[model samples]
Target: MASSRLYLSAKSAAALDAELMSSGGFSLDQLMELAGLSCAQAVYKSHPPESKRNVLIIAGPGNNGGDGLVAARHLKLFGYDPVVYYPKRPNKDIYNRLFTQLSNLKVSFTDDVNKAITETDQILDAIFGFSFQPPIRDPFVQVIRLLESTEKPVISVDIPSSWNVDSGPPKSGELGAAFMPDVLVSLTAPKPAAKFFKGRHFLGGRFVSKEIAKKWGFSLPDYPGVDQIVELPADNEKL
Candidate 1:
């Protein structure tokens, strides 16, 4: 993970997350890949694809759902047949475009989250983005409960579902009341909530950063010290 502290308050992070969706960073579909790839790297680190393990992705209705769909598509590209489960029908136009892309890739989508959970080796929680609205009920709550029961390792994109990224975790105070994701994949910068409230469970990495060449391990084309234009050897010297 590229380590550089780009600070932003939870509120700011949420705002940026929202703004980036609107800005042409690369359309909503591309932002989905940005968010999804961040989580996918964590999954790859934990469970390498060569092992042939199953990954279950829980998608919500909004852009969060788009992130999971993006991840599922990438996982398929990486040779992992991830099962994607979204409880509600996707309502966003971006999500619809993503659904079409996933269909083109032949990735499976289902509403049967229970079955998806039952069979996967790893679970990815992509249900909620940074924004949190209250009155957590039915399908989402039930899905959270099922995930709690499962012993599989879980990765969450942005914040886990049923938890407010701003105010903190859920307050139902049940046995597994508050949301806890094993790995929390953050984009661009770390959210304040993930730093202060989330404690040791938080793990963040950026999607893309401004740069070129070899400042760090990553190499970029035409980067300052790297791939600098130089004169070719003279014909006599070549001999």
Candidate 2:
């Protein structure tokens, strides 16, 4: 049976990225842009019409943050105030470009993580991605606390921080204390992490995608699956 329910493992997700980069002819940067754009589309849908909803992105020093920075730029284009919380500067060359783009776009930035958490209605957890190792602590842990306490809806990019994408178990002790995401914006594919971890425990979150579904011949009916993912074919043709 082609199950109405579909689930993806982390390894499958990696393979999807490799295929998209090599066969589909998209660069990593392009993929990141699509990932962010997909995420922004979801956030826009969930937001109420009247309030000028704030999107606070918790960015760390890696590709995850790069994704968040990309999302922030797109969010701004859609007229939302996206405040980025950079706990640390990203070291990767790819992120340097992301930094430059954010700078040129004039998106706001703050080192005060606490303040950023307090001021926003929506939080994007780009602090950690799927490649993370255990023992989540310090600034990441602190950010988790803020995410939990903010009591606002959180939309995690790729995977939630302090979560093992493979094991599908949340971190123990202080790390486990954080709140679960209201939505997880898995890039280029759905993930076992997003599906099982929340499902097994009855923790609530929805797996959202725009890029991966298009590449894989799947579709998201309830979200902006069409405008973002389906439109990419025309974009690719312009290249």
Give the best candidate by lDDT. Answer: 2
What's the true lDDT of residue 142 in model 2?
Answer: 74
**Model 1 segments more than 4 A misplaced:** 1-7, 18-26, 172-178, 196-239
Model 1 agreement with the true structure over 1-239: per-residue lDDT tens digits: 23223334456665655655554254656666766765666677657777736888888877777778888887888778788887776566777777888889988877788888878888888887776576666788788888677777777776766666655565576523555666666555444445433322323333334341122223121212321111111221121
- Model 2 lDDT on a 0 to 1 scale: 0.67
lDDT of each: 0.63, 0.67
lDDT of 1: 0.63
TM-scores, all candidates, are: 0.74, 0.78
**Which whole-number lDDT from 0 to 100 does residue 21 have in model 2?**
81
Model 2 poorest 10 in a row by lDDT: 230-239
